[model samples]
Structure formats: C-alpha cells, structure tokens
Target: MKQRSEQSQGTVYGFLAYLLWGAFPLYFAALKPATAFEVLCHRILWTLVVCLIALAATKQLRFLRDLARDPRRLGTMAVAGVLIAINWVVYIFAVVTGHTVEAALGYFLNPLVTVALGVIVLREKLRPLQWVAVGVGVIACVYLAIDYGRPPLISITLALTFAAYGLMKKRIGGSANALQSLAAESAVLAPVAVVILAVITARGETTFTTQGVGHTLLLLSTGIATAVPLLLFAAAASRVPLVTIGLLQFITPVLQLLCGVLVLGEHMNLARWIGFAIVWVALAILTVDSLQATTRARRLARAAQGAAC
Candidate 1:
C-alpha cells in the first residue's frame, strides 16, 4: 500500500510537470511583436525578482552568502546558468517563430544527449540496453539531418545545451535549493540583460514599450512559467525515483510534436514519421528496462524490510 501511494504520487507529479512544460509554447508564441531576445531579457529580469522573493520568504539568505564564497559548485552552477539561459532563449525563439516541431525534436533528443553526457562528464556506465537506445536516437538524428540537407541546428543546440545543463545540475547535487540556484543563475545573466535593454532603449529600438501592456506581462509570465515548473520538478524529484521521472520527460516533447503538427501546422513528412518511430522504439526499450529494473529493486527492498521485521 505504501509503495502504491508513492507510485501514485510520482505519477501525479510527473503528469503535472509534463503538463506545465507541454503548454509552454502557447505562452511564448503569444508574444508576437517582441523578438525572442527581448522576451528573454524580461524573463531573466523577472525570474530574478521572483527568486529574490523566494529567498526572502524562505530565509535562505545565508545560502546565498555562502554561495559567493564557495567557488567550486558556484562556478559549476554559473556554467549551468549560461547553458540553460541559452537554451531557454533558443526554445522561445523556436516556438515563437513556428518551429515548435523542431523545439519538440530538441527536447526529444535531450534525454539521449543527457545520457551521453553522463558517460562523458560523470564517467557513468550505461547498461547494454541504454547503449542501444542511444544508438537508435543517434541514427534517427542522422537520418533527419540527411533529409533536411543541413543539420537541425535549432534542435541540436537546444538538446546539447540542455543536456549539458542537466549534467551540471546533477554535479551540483542537493547542495543548493532550487530557488537559490535559480537566483544565482539569474544573477549571472541579469547584468547582461540590463546592458542590452539599456542599449536597445537608448537607440529607440525597444520592442517592449510599443508592444502594448498586454504582451509585456505575458512575457513576464515566462519567468514564472520557467521557475514554478523547476520548483515542481524539484518537489517531484525529491519524492520520486529517477526512473519514474525519466518516463515523465516524454510528455512535453510528445505534446510539442502534436502542437506542431496540428496547431502550428508544421509539415510532417514520411521522413519525419520514420524518424519519430525510431525515437519511439528507443524510448520503449529504455522504458521497459527501467520498469524491469524498478521492479527488481522494489522486490529486493521489500525482502530486506521483511527480514528486518
């Protein structure tokens, strides 16, 4: 019964996380007049404000203080911040400009890239099945790139940057609260945004002023959209197994792909379908392995508990 309850909680949290992420394109796509760069600036600025409020409310001021003195993890997080910031900016550009399918492809490729990053950066060994899954994903990308002539650079950039960000965050471990890390990262980007916005304003080329009041707040909503999901992911991650969370990662990309084909009207040719089928098969292999592994772990744990009792 206890196991069932935890599983249910994991499923619920995973779905909610996916739902928040899946619908993100709608929010970003609404800001038509403002370019992705302009919206990115506001997102960085407001997320910083929200992160500050969270720091004050939680009284984690000391963590922030100590963070300044700790160079190792702090520097790692700074690199992570740059990576994710670039990712967010590019993702926004992709979605706003009707490249939602490419954006979805980026996310779909991200997990496989993250798995590769684990091997490269963390020296983690993958199971044989995981290696096969990675191979399938790579072949799918290669095929897609061939069909497109050039590489899918937007999707490739998003995947690589985000995968690197995930690896870096994993490197940071549980030492920092989600809010604190976001605050620190936002702090890292805030100066550049200020300078850019200032320059844009001085030159009379600012989009924010003329885009009307409605669109501006919608852009601000991006920060909340970005941060709130991370907090939820943190909450979910703490309470759930890594395997369960891994399954949930598929939800966002699936939704984005649907949105692209049905809503945004991106062309889905035979090659795209074949590529997606390859990805699906890879995910199936990985997910089956994960489920089998989870079941074995549960049985062993329960047996150990019974022995103790």
Candidate 2:
C-alpha cells in the first residue's frame, strides 16, 4: 500500500514536471529579442542563485562543501554542465527560429538514443519489443530526412547533446545529490555567463540593459523556469520506477509538438506528420513493452515470496 501510494504521488509529480517542461518553448519564446546566448547566461546565473537559496533554506548546504572536497566529481559535473548548456542553447535556438517542430522531433528521438547508449555502453539487454521499437524509430528518422530533403540537424544535434548529457550524469553515479550536481554545473558555467553579461553590457548590447521591464523580468525568470521542473523530476524519480518515469517523459516533446503546430503556427507538411506518427507508434510500442516487463517482474517477485512462505 505504501508502494502504491508512492507510485501515485510519483505520477502526480512526474505529470507536473513534464507538463512544466513541455511548456518551456512558450516560456523561452516570451524572452525573445534576447539572444539565445544572453538568455542562456541569465538562466545559468539565476538557476545557480535559486538553487543556492533552496539549499540554504533546506539546510542542505553541506552538499556543496562535500562536493568541494571532491575535485574529480566536480570535473565530471563540469563536463555534464557543458553538455546541458549546449542542449539548452540549441533548444532555445530551435524555439526562437521557429523550428520548434524539429526540436520536438529531437526530444521524440531522445528515448531511443538513450536506449541505444545503454545497450552500447552498459551492455544492457533489450527486450525483443524494444529492438522493434528502436527499428521503427530509425525508420521514422529516415522518413523525416527524406521529407526534409536533408538531415534534420536541429533534431539530431539536440538528441545527441541531450543523450550525451544523460550519459555523463549516469556515469557520475551518486557522487553528488541532485541539487549539488546542478549547483556544481551552474557554478562551472557561471563565470562564463558573467563574462558574457559583462561583455554585452560593456557594448550596450545586453538585452537586460536595453529591454523594457517586462522583458527583463522574463529574462530573469529563466532561472525559475529552468529549476522548477528539474526539482519536480527529482522528486518523482525518487518515488517511481525508472520505467514509469520513462513513460511520463514523452509528455514534454508531445506538448512541444502541439505548441509548434497550433500555437506557433509552423508549417507541418503531410510527410512530416506521417513521420511523427511513425515515431509516436514506436514510442507506444516501447512504452507497452516497458509496462509488460515491469508487470512480469512484479508477478515473479510475488510468486517467489509466496513460494518461500
């Protein structure tokens, strides 16, 4: 019963997390006229500030001292930080340049990429259904490429960078808590961000310097926008099985796709739609396979317990 309750709560947290993340394009869109770099800089600085405040409020500031004692983990987080920054900037570029649909495609492709990484890097076994889902995802990519008359660079880059970021974070293991890891990453990026802000300010080209109050606030809010979903996701992950979390992750890109088509009014050709459908079918297959596998594992565990009794 406790497990069930945790799962239920996890579902709620995961839903909120992904819902917030799915709404990101809208948030970033509102910060427009600010260059992606400028927005990224503010996001890094403000995220660090907010995270520090949270850590202090929660009496979790010890994590920082612990991290400071471990240089190797800090270095690993530095690499992860760079990767995430790249991912963030690319996503912002996708939104601002009106290629949000392609951005959505990248996220749609992320799970497949992560799975491939797992198989290759971790020597993990994939169920037959998983292999089939991956194959279908590949077909979808091919279809998209053909339809676009070229490779989808934005999509592919986003997938690769984010996949790499996930890989690095996983490799980091439990070296740092979630907030600690983020704080480290933000700290690593903060100097660069500050320099960026300084340079732009010196030239009188900084958006915050020149923009209206509304725009400045929007720019500053990137910190909250960046941090909140991550906090929710961390909470959800602690309570849910990885498989359940995986299922919920799709909410983000699906929402982005909707925003791109309905709100942003991007042109979606029939071919692109068909390709997206194929990817969705692949995701459906993967999700069902994960659910069945989890159910089978639970059943086996219960049977073992009964047999022991």
Candidate 3:
C-alpha cells in the first residue's frame, strides 16, 4: 500500500510538473511589458535568489561549498547554464511573440534530437526502430521546411540547445542532485543576468519597475515558475520508473501544442498539420521501441535469476 501510494504521488507530481511546463506560454504572455531578454535576466536572478533561500532553509549550503571546491564541476555547470539560458530565452521569445505553435513543435522534436545526439555524441548504438524514428523526424523537419519556404529555425534551435543541455547534464552524472545542480547553474549565470538587467535599466527600457505592481509580481513569479516544476519533476523521478517518466514527458509538449492552436489561435493549415502528424508517428515508433527494449531487459533479468536458483 505504501509503495502504491508513493507511485501514485509520483504520478501526480510528474503530471503537475508537465502541466505547468505546458502552460508556460500563458505565464510568459502575461509579462507583456518585458522583453524575452528581460524576463530571462529576471528569471536567472530570481532563480538564484530562490535557490539560495532554499539552500539556507534546508541547510543544504554544503552543495554550494562542494561546488566551490570542484572547479571541473563548476566549469561543466557554467557551460550547462549558458546553454539552458539560451533555451529559456528562445522559448520565452516564442511565447511572447506569438510563435507558440513553433515552440510546441520544437519540444515535440526534442526527444528525437536527443536520441540523435546520443548516437553522435555518446556513440551509442541505435536499434532499427530507433533509427527509423530518427529518419522520420528528419523527414518531418524537411516537410515543414518546404512548407514554410525555410527551415523552422525556432524549432530547430530549441531542440538543439536543449539536446546539448541534456547531454551536458548526463555527462556530469551524479555530481549534484537536481536542486543543487539548478542552484549551481543559476549561481553561475547570475552575474551576467545582473549585468543585463543593469544595461536595460540604464536604457530606461526596463519593464519590471515601470510595469506596475501586477507586472512586477508577474516578473518575480518567473523564478517560482522555473523552480517549482523542476522540484516536482525531481520528486517524481526519485519515485517512479524510467518508462513512466518517459511517457509523462510528452504531456508537456502535447499541452503546449493544444495551447498554441486552441488558446493562442495559431494558424495550422493542412501542410503544418501533416508535418505534425509525421512527427507524432515518429514519436510513437520511438515509444514502442523503448517499451520493447525495457521488456526484453526485464525478461533477461528474470531468466538470469531463475538460472541462478
């Protein structure tokens, strides 16, 4: 019963995390007076503040001390931070500039991008089905590009930057848990974020101060918006199976797509819909391949256990 309860809780946490992430378009849209760069800067600054507060509150200051001592880890995290900042700014630009559909497409392509990156960067071997999935993803991009008369730059940029970030995090291994790593990344980026804020303020184009109480509050909430879902995702990951996490991850992009078409009223003609359909088919193939592999691994483990007996 306790195990079941924990799994249930994990599912809820994972769902909530993805739901919030999917709904991020709405949140970013609310910060109208702020440019994507301004929001990105504030997000970095405030996320650092929140992380510091959490460290103090939870007595996890050791994370900071340990990070300070490991120059290699710090350097790795610094690179990861910059990559993530790029991802955030681009995503924010999509949301705030009426490109939510393109943003959603970006995330939809992210998994396939990650898989291709694994093959290239990690030199991991892909199964036949996985290879087919990747091929289909490429075809989808080509189709979309032809339809648009150009490459979907926003989508490709988001996928590449995020894939690079994921690779960096994976290379880092268990040097820091989720929260500690986030705090460290934010800390690494904070100085640059502060400088950006200063420049914007000097230009008298700053939105946070001039935008009134509601807007200021919305800008401040970016920290919470960034942190809370991450914390929830961490909690879910700690308790759930990897397959479950993989499946849950799709909820985010699916919701974003819905928000784009339904809420934001982005135009999706037959060509765009066809492109999206191809991507979904690719994702389905990948999902089935993953499940089959997992099943095979489990069956092998059971056979080995029986042979030992």
Candidate 4:
C-alpha cells in the first residue's frame, strides 16, 4: 500500500513537471524584447540563486563540499552544465522566434536520440524492436528534411545536446541528488552568465532594466520556472518505476506540440503532419518494446524467487 501510494504521488509529480514544461513556450513567448541570450543568462544566475537557497533550507550544503572534493564528478557536471546551457538557449530561441513547433519536434525526437546515444556512447545493444524504432526515426528525420528543404537543425541540435546532457547525468549516477546536481551545474555556468549579463547591460540592450516592473519580475521568475519542474521530476523519479517514468515523459512533448499547433497557431503543412505521424509511430514502437522488456525482467525475477523457495 505504501508503494502504491508512492507511485501515485510520483504520477502526480511527473504530470505537474511535464505540465509546467509544456507551458514554457507560453512563458518564454511572453518575455519579448529580451533576447534568448539575455534570458539564458538570467535563467542561469537566478537558478543558481534559487538552488543555493533551497540547498541552505534543506541543510544540503554539505553536498557542495563533497562535490568539490570529487574532481571527476565536478568535471562531468561542468560538461553537463555546458550541454544544458546550449539546450536552454536553443529552446528559448525556438520559443521566442516562432519555432515552437520545431522545439516540440525536438523533444519528440529526444528519446530516440537517447537510445542511439546509449548504443554509441555506452556500448549498449538495442533490442530488435528498438532497432526498428530507431530506423523509423531516421526515416522520419529524412522525410522532415525533404519537406523542409533542409535538415531540421533546431530539432536536431536540441535532441543531441539534451541527450548528451542526459548521458552526463547518467555518468554522474546517484552521486548527487537533483538539487545538488542542478546547483552544481548552475554554479559552473554562473561565471559566464555574469559576464554575459554585464555585456548586455553595457550595450544598453538588456531588457531586464528597460522592460518595466512586470517584465522584470517575469525575468526574475525564470528561476522558479526552471527549478520547480526539475524538482518535481526528481521527486517522481525517486518514487516511480523506470517504465512509469518512461511513459510519463511523453506528456511533455505532447503538450508542447499541442501548444504549438493549437495555441501558438504554428503552420503545419500536410508534409510536416505526415513527418510527425512517422515519428509518433517510432515512439509507439519503442514504448511497446520497453513495456515488454520490463515485463520480461519482472517475470524472470519472480521465477527466480519461486525456484529459490
């Protein structure tokens, strides 16, 4: 019963995380006159501030000391920080520049990119169905390229950078909790963020100061916007099964896609629709394969327990 309750809580946490993430395009779109770069810098610095406060409140500052002593983990987190920074800037650019649909497509493609990264970087082998799903994903990309008259660079970059960031987090493993990890990443990028803000201010191009109180508050609120969903996701991950997490991940991209098409009024031609359809087919294939694999693993565990008894 406790486990079931935990799982239910996790589902709620996961849903809220994805819901907030899905609504990000609207938030970012509202931050007009602030260039993506300016927004990213503010995001990094403010997120660091928020993380520090959370760490202090939770009495988890000791993790920072531990992280400092571990050079390898620190270095890995630094790289992860860079990767996430890239992802953030690109995503913000997509949202602010009327490329929300492309942003949605990128997230939709992220799981497949993660699978390919596992095979290439982690030396993991894909199951037959997984391979087929990946193949279909490739075809979808090709179709999208043909339809767009060029590769979907925004989508591809978002997918690749985010997948690489995930790999870095995987390497970090359980060495750090989500709050600690985010704090460290933000710290690593804080110096650069400071410099960027300074440059923007010097050039008189910063929207933070010129944009009125409400806009200034909106920019400041980016910190909470970035941190809350991540914390919720961490909470969900701790409580839920991997399969549940996997299934719930789709909520984010699906919401983004809906926001882009229905809310943002992004134009989606027939070709683009067909391309998205193909990607969905690949995702469906992958989902089924993951579910079956989880079931088999559970069955094997049960059979082993029965044999031992």
What TM-score fits each model? 0.93, 0.95, 0.98, 0.99
- Evaluated against the true structure, the overall lDDT of model 2 is 0.90
**Best TM-score goes to which candidate?**
4
Off by over 4 Å in 1: 1-7, 303-309
- Encode model 4's per-residue lDDT on 1-309: one tens digit a residue: 999999999999998998999899989999998999999999999999999999999999998888889898899999999999999999999998999999999999999999999999999999999999999999999999999999999999999999999999999999889999999999999999999999999998999978799999999999999999999999999999999989988888888888889998999999999999999999999999999999999999999999999
Candidate 3 C-alpha error for residue 213, in Å:
0.4
**Which one wins by TM-score: 1 or 4?**
4
| Model 3 stretches astray by more than 4 angstroms | none
Better of 2 and 3 by TM-score: 3
lDDT of each structure? 0.85, 0.90, 0.93, 0.95
What lDDT score is found at residue 221 in candidate 3?
Answer: 84
Candidate 3 clashing pairs, residues 3+ apart or interchain: none
Model 2: residues >4 Å from true position, as ranges?
none
Error of 1 at 70 (Å): 1.6
Ranking by lDDT: 4, 3, 2, 1
Model 4 worst lDDT run, 10 consecutive residues: 251-260
Error of 3 at 133 (Å): 0.1
Cα lDDT of model 2 by residue, 188-218, tens digit: 9999999998998888878895779899888
lDDT of 3 by residue, 1-309 (tens): 999899999999999999999999888988986999999999998898888888889999888888889899999999999999999999999988999999999999999999999989999999999999999999999999999999999999999999999999997888788888899999999999999999999999999989799999988988888999999999999888888989999998888888888998888999999999999999999999999999999999999999999
Clashing pairs in 4: none
Model 2, residue 205: C-alpha shift (Å): 2.3
